[model samples]
Target: MRRDHPMPCPDRHDALAELALGTLAGQERSDVLAHVARCHACALELSELSRITDDLLQLAPAASPPVGFELRVVERVLACSTSAPTGRPRRRKRHRLASWRPAAVAALLAAVVGTGAGLLAASTTAGKAPPAASRPVTLSASLARHGRVFGHVRVSSGRTPWLFVTVDDLTGPGSRTVICEVTLVDGTTAKLGRFRLSQGYGSWGVPLAAPADSLRRALLVGTDGSVLASARI
Candidate 1:
């Protein structure tokens, strides 16, 4: 039998967040990986946070000014100077300066508009949900064989549901293709996907159509039709 680890401690959760953000490295990274392997709640949290991180990256990529923007500003300033009035030297100088003034003002306004637009977009996205609701509910279960724990199954719930499986400490083969199947409440089994394990260690995740709570159990099967491990949800 395997002991159930409690939900993430503050330090653990902070580590998980850093891991998801791709900022954790060195000994700290290795420690978090080892801990997540055995901690169900922390693993689920990491998975959810990872998905949120991915979405954020996709939604807000790096921003830059439009192409040739600087060149266009220079052209406008040059055009204003070239078209300056030439009747009187002093008056021409004043007119040239006045012409440059409009160009500078236009350039400033363009910059202000670009910055305001970016701010508005960020605010709109942030307004969609409260900070507390950013992390969705994720569920987990232990996979075992003959009363000995071997792996874990995690399900994330939100607009996009996901099924994540991790296997460690399995014996018998160096490499094998494992099939992930889920049993619904009505006794129906659905094969989510398959992944290869290297020396009894690997992790895989796939988007799921059914909600997380609808699953009754998760199973890991070998290509040879042998039941490797099973987890009750």
Candidate 2:
């Protein structure tokens, strides 16, 4: 008789959010799904993430954009990049797993991930997830007294807008009011969006009204006029 070996796996835990939001595909998706079927821990996690994603769906707006609205932002980013100083962006850690799901899911993923139930099951496989486009630009920042964050940029990151930013690894008070901003290469800032990080994980995926390529920095400013984290774009 031949011995049976388990199927190959990868970083399935990191992709639960993507899987719940229907973004993961190919072997990566299948592996996570399969693992969830056999692993009790993963199944519960999948259920929680799925429930969170469904809740955010209610807050999403259904509408179209005005004529030429995107054009203006694109033009601005282009204009600034031409006059901006050149510097290498910080090195980004590449992952074969999905970057993030949708914007709403990203926000929810950030908050709940701090809970004991939101932590993903551990796995050590080298398989890669489906590639969306060219690798996104990633940036990082830290709060003045406490907290740290990283942002991922993708134009096709989600359905709401042309600019998609995935903010992750936020640490600090859960109920802080903060404004996220993106600084253009030309030294002007554009508002990315606002996230009121609740008690839990502080990861958020927000839509910015600007171009990712022209962004030079990302700032998380508190309501009290303190910088939570400053990230290089």
**Top-scoring candidate (TM-score):** 1
Q: Please give the lDDT score for candidate 2.
A: 0.48
TM-score of 1: 0.42
TM-score for each predicted model, relative to the true structure: 0.42, 0.35
**Model 2: per-residue Cα lDDT over 38-143, one tens digit each:** 8766677778779999999989998865322243233333334443436532222222224333343334333322211111111111232332344444332332
Off by over 4 Å in 2: 1-174
How big is the positional error of residue 103 in model 1, measured in Å on the Cα after superposition?
A: 45
lDDT of 1 by residue, 45-117 (tens): 8887899998897887677653333433453445445664443222111122223333333333333322312
Name the 10 consecutive residues with the lowest summed lDDT in model 1.
Answer: 88-97
